[model samples]
Target chain A: MTVRELAALPEFEAVCLPDGEREILGGYAGDLLSWVMGRASEGDAWVTIMSNVNIVAVSTLADPACIVLSEGVAPDGDTLERAKEQGINILTTSLDTFDACVRIASAL
Target chain B: MTDKVNFHFDIDGDNFTSAGEASVRIKKLLREMGFSPDTIRRVSVAMYEGEINMVIHANGGSADVDVYGDRIEIILADKGPGIPDIDLAMQEGYSTAPDNIRSLGFGAGMGLPNMKRYTDDMRIESALGVGTTIYMTVKT
Candidate 1:
């Protein structure tokens, strides 16, 4: 399913920036960068509460289709700007990390 | 014919957030070199795991990547307190990291296993109070 479809699900809250286009499916939730790097797949949706610029770098290396920042966390200004520059879709939601994962999985 | 590329990085032990920088760079380099996406992802993931282990357990280390016509080799060397039991350390959930490290979402004890999972060959040369070296390779 597309990111737009996932965003419309009841469990997911849309904090998407104006420019991001929703695409890809499958949710991988984990804060451990190493594990995620190993397990997360291309076209997978990453649900993380990590709100740092390096998270973007990790996401880039992992090549996830979209990033969902859960637990009411918001990216720093620099992070948001970098996301825009990288053309990476960013979403934020109020649900906790695990709950967000469950929602994304169910949507899948 | 020698078709090889060498890349070197000094991983910073103190910076938690910047731990994966080298892996990211390597990923970009592999992409630019025209590696297949699967090969690039495997190299990046295995290298990232080793980088994290160096930062969190070994107080940082040096990583060297050798890309050749048929395979990619990664060597991570560190002077941290070496692993006592290579067998135990290779387990899925065994970890020596402190509680604080766990809070940062690491210390899951999956580093080595994941490295082995992604790489075609992995060898650990380590000694207590001495140091450790990991050599991993992924075939193209």
Candidate 2:
């Protein structure tokens, strides 16, 4: 599903997504930043509770179309600022990681 | 042919929030230089993992990147407590990072292994009391 479509869903909230309206190809879920760095494919929607500035770097390097911060994960001021600077799509959801992924899969 | 372009960065270990800035910069630089997507991704991922390790374990370090016609080389040097057992450290799911670091979504024991997985070549030189230096290469 496109990032625009997913963000429009009530299941998730668009906290700050400059790229939210873009199309996202798929979902890759992992909390370990390094694992996601190695495993996440370009344009995949990364699902994680890690709300850190490094996630911005990982998303940029991995070329994820969007990052879904699951479980209502609240990134710090630094993370939010970096996310904006990097201009990557970031969404937050109260749903757990599994539920978030399921929602994403169905949307796709 | 031109001389290798070099970039140097001082990683800040005091702030977890600032850790991977160097890798991000390198990734951007490579992209601007028109490195292939796979090569840029591999170099950036390996360097970022090493940068995170330096922050979590070595209390920050220095990173140097050299860009050449055939490949990119990354050198990470740190003075933190050295890894006593390289083999064990290289093993997947083996990490010495503290709980606090883990809470930040790192310290999964996947750092080094993932670094190796992405880079074309990787080498680790570490000591018990001194420090560790990692060398990684990603071919263009």
Candidate 3:
């Protein structure tokens, strides 16, 4: 499914839809940026609670289709701006990491 | 190889916020040069892990990316404390990064291993209390 389609689901809300047209092929759940970088494949939907500026770099390197900030975590201003600049679609959900993973897995 | 283009960057050891800047820039350059997305991602991830290592353990360093027709060579050098055990360092679950770094979403003991995993070739040269230099290459 495309990022736009995922945003429409009740599982998550599109807080920053920088590239909603990108397609989500799978999902990776991790809080460690390095681990995610090593394991996340291209077009994966990265599910995490990380809300830092480095998330932009990890997303860029991993080329994840989108980033889901679980548990209602909010990114800092700088992170949000950088995410937009890099065309990284970020979604937020009230669900915790585990539930968010389940939701994304089912969606995919 | 004489005609190969080279890009150099000085990684500031003091600022964690500025880490990974070089990798991101290189990703853009490779994209503009029409490299395949997979190759760009490999180079980007390798360089990014090296950059993060320099900031977290080496107090910053210098990175030189040599772009050639068939491959991209990345050499990262730092004057910080060197690695004493290369074998241990290469392990997937070994890290010396402080807790603060872990709090920032790094220091999960995957940096060097990930760098090697993404690059075609990797080498580490270091001297105790002198410095460390990492050599990595990714094929186009």
The runs of at least 3 residues in candidate 3 whose Cα sits more than 4 Å from the true structure, single-residue gaps closed, are none
Quantify all predictions' global Cα lDDT against the true fold.
Answer: 0.83, 0.88, 0.90
Give the clashing residue pairs of candidate 2, or none: none
Candidate 2 structure quality by residue, lDDT tens digits, A1-108: 678788899988777778866778888999888888878889898999988777888888898989999987877788788889989888889999999999999889
Positional deviation of residue B58's Cα in model 2 after best superposition, in angstroms: 1.1
| lDDT score at residue B63, model 3, on the 0-100 scale | 95
Interface RMSD of every candidate? 2.2, 1.0, 0.8
Q: What TM-score does model 1 achieve against the real structure?
A: 0.85
Which candidate tops TM-score? Answer: 3
Tens digits of lDDT, candidate 1, A6-46:
77776665554443455675778888766777788887889
lDDT of 3 by residue, B1-140 (tens): 54789999999989877788899999999899899998898898999999999999888999999999889999999998999999999998899989988898998999999989989999999999999999998987
Better of 1 and 3 by lDDT: 3
In model 2, the fraction of reference contacts reproduced equals 0.89
Off by over 4 Å in 2: none
Which 10 consecutive positions of candidate 1 chain B have the poorest summed lDDT?
A: B99-108
Scored against the true structure, residue A93 in model 1 reaches a CA lDDT of 86
Writing each residue's lDDT as its tens digit, candidate 3 over A7-100 gives: 9998789988978999999999999999999899899999998898899888988899999999889888888898888898999999998998
DockQ of each: 0.60, 0.84, 0.85
Question: Distance from true position, residue B111, model 1, in Å?
Answer: 0.4
lDDT of 1 at B138: 99
